[model samples]
Target: MKVLSKSISLFVVCLIVITIWWIGTDGFTGFTQETARVNKLIEEKPMIMPITLEDSKGRMYTFHELKGRRLFLTFIYTSCGTVCPQLEKNMQQVYESLPREILDEKIMFLTISFDPDRDTVEVLDTYRQYFGSDGETWRMARIANKLELKELLDAFGVIVLPDRYGGFTHNSAFYYVDENGRLTNVLDYKDIEGAQAFLHNELLGSEMK
Candidate 1:
């Protein structure tokens, strides 16, 4: 009787351990599946053109590098003391709140300057530092030509109308890209809160470590 009881107790303990392990793995697996479902819905949204550009540091990074991770990209001119400043601050908030693991997990941030003629590599570098960028994972690029910038913006469906005071009245949007390097959603820069939640639930939440 004693031998039988010991064997039964051991079997029960093993069963319990297996149950916990299964739950630990399966729970996150289920969440990933749900995230995938939402991502499929996100794919139905219109796509944007991908640009290959040189960063302030002279490194070449393409939209292709953005694959296997999530991307948040924006257009800005550093010299503007207007809405651009507000947008930068809001972007800082979004970046600060993101999980560190997510930042390391193939995530990218791209800031393209509209006034590329004045936004040389030196200017871009200084501007990026103002936003507290560490330079390990972000790209700040200069447009190099007014016409080229306008054409690219138009291709992406973002418009930048010149302001009389040398600044521009441009469309303010924060673009999201998925792990497949495909363009996803375009949200207002001021909608940082909503943007964070959307990306977390729809993208990062499904990321494999």
Candidate 2:
């Protein structure tokens, strides 16, 4: 009788272990499937911006260049005393935390300087160094004129004004574009972690179980 009771107890314990394992496996699989579905949905609805502009290297870049990659964009000028630096710093963190595969395979970063007259290629090069920018992968382009700058800003609903001290007063919003070049979300300049996770999970497909 004692032996039978021990055997029954052992069998019950094994059965429970197997059941827990099964549950865990199935739960993980479901989560993976859902994540893939979400990414596909996002890709299907990418935002396409019709920006026809030149980079610091004088190469023409537009919405078409972003067809197969995610993009992070913001407006800044080299001589700004505030806000622009903070936005660049936040972007650096986001860029660093991104997986190399995503950075290589699915991501691009663009910082277009709103001050055309001042932010020449030389100034952009200097500014890029402050952010440890590698010219091949990342870019800081200067707008050709105030009119082009205003049109782009208006299209994106970003506003800029000059202060009494010749400084810029501008909205600090970081724009996120998806793999299909669709503008997906706007992040605050200080929201580093939120932006990090947002980019990591969506652009890199990190939540792909």
Candidate 3:
């Protein structure tokens, strides 16, 4: 009787452990699948809508208006003393390296200030001038409306967190939009070669098309 009772207890413990393991594994798998599904949905959608925004010059235009030109865009704020400047510099280098025809006629660069409250038109203009950005080819702008700003950041997958120093800690990346205004590729801000290659391929592919 003692032997039978011990055997039963061991089986029950094993059964309990197996049950818990199965439940945990199943839940994890489901969560992973859901996450992947959501990511796919986001990837399939266009990066920007036709929402109108104000530029540093206070000119109103929708991103859709830029449909005929390839766009390289990044998020930045005038107050940022760290990553934003580096990002702008990298973008400038990429812009300078590209063929003048592409730079002049086919491509454009945009630096958008996420901190709309503080980064007014004057502030953005000063920031652009500080970077010595050519106002025509390289433009700086900000979305003035708070709600629209959040929506734009979310669309670009940019997460902004307030740092201890009253600056922002945000996702830093270059968003490459095709001539048709589709979000074709996203590269790290540090990847100057990658940005160039992407542009080359995109321009070539568009020519072929």
Candidate 4:
């Protein structure tokens, strides 16, 4: 009876260990699966609808100009004090980690402000300065037209809601587009390491093609 009880206890402990391992690994496994799924979706539908937007200099920008460059894009507003700052910081880290050749020649980093009413071209320029961005590799912009902004946000799956403190809450992530302008991957801001890995392995080399 004593030996049988000991064996049962050992089996239960092993079961618990296995359960913990599965739970710990589920997040990475899920992210990998999601990446595969999104890749397949891009393969099926190659083209994304083009939208016109304005940069901090009040100059018109379009997707056509982004062709043949790996695009790292995100949405943020100057008034946001919560996730936006950290999200941008993570992007900055990813940008700094890359080789200068990739940053200057092969990649474009874009931050678009969803709050057009409050985030004018001047305001975005100030915000860009605060982040120490030179606007060469990392460019900040805002959508001028309300209707077009709504369509752009909806297309990218960004949801914005008004908060009680006169600010807004929104989902933030990096939208990764290939050199061909195909929407490829959506990396959440929390996955900084994953973003860096994708940049080094997929974007910088010929593996992505």
Candidates in order have lDDT scores of 0.71, 0.74, 0.80, 0.80
- State residue 132's C-alpha deviation in candidate 2, in Å: 1.1
Candidate 3, superposed: residue stretches over 4 Å from native = 1-42
Measured against the true structure, the TM-scores of the candidates, in listed sequence, are 0.71, 0.71, 0.77, 0.76
In model 4, the clashing pairs are none
What's the residue-level lDDT of 60 in candidate 3? 86
Instruction: Judge candidate 1 at residue 86 and give its lDDT.
Output: 88
Model 2: per-residue lDDT, tens digit, 1-209? 99999999999999899788667556344344333333443445445556666676767767676677767888898898778898898888888887676677777888988888888877888788899677656778876766767877765666678889887887767777766666666676687999888876786464475
Worst 10 residues of 2 by lDDT: 33-42
Cα lDDT, model 4, residue 112: 91
Candidate 1: misplaced stretches above 4 Å?
A: 1-50, 145-148
How many residue pairs clash in model 4? 0
RMSD of each: 15.8, 13.5, 5.6, 6.4
User: How many clashes does each candidate structure show, in the order listed?
Assistant: 0, 2, 0, 0
lDDT (Cα) of model 3: 0.80
Q: Sorted by lDDT, highest first, which candidate order results?
A: 4, 3, 2, 1
Point to the candidate with the largest TM-score.
3
Between which residue pairs do clashes occur in model 1?
A: none
Task: Flag regions of model 2 displaced more than 4 Å.
Answer: 1-48, 206-209
- Give me the overall lDDT of model 1: 0.71
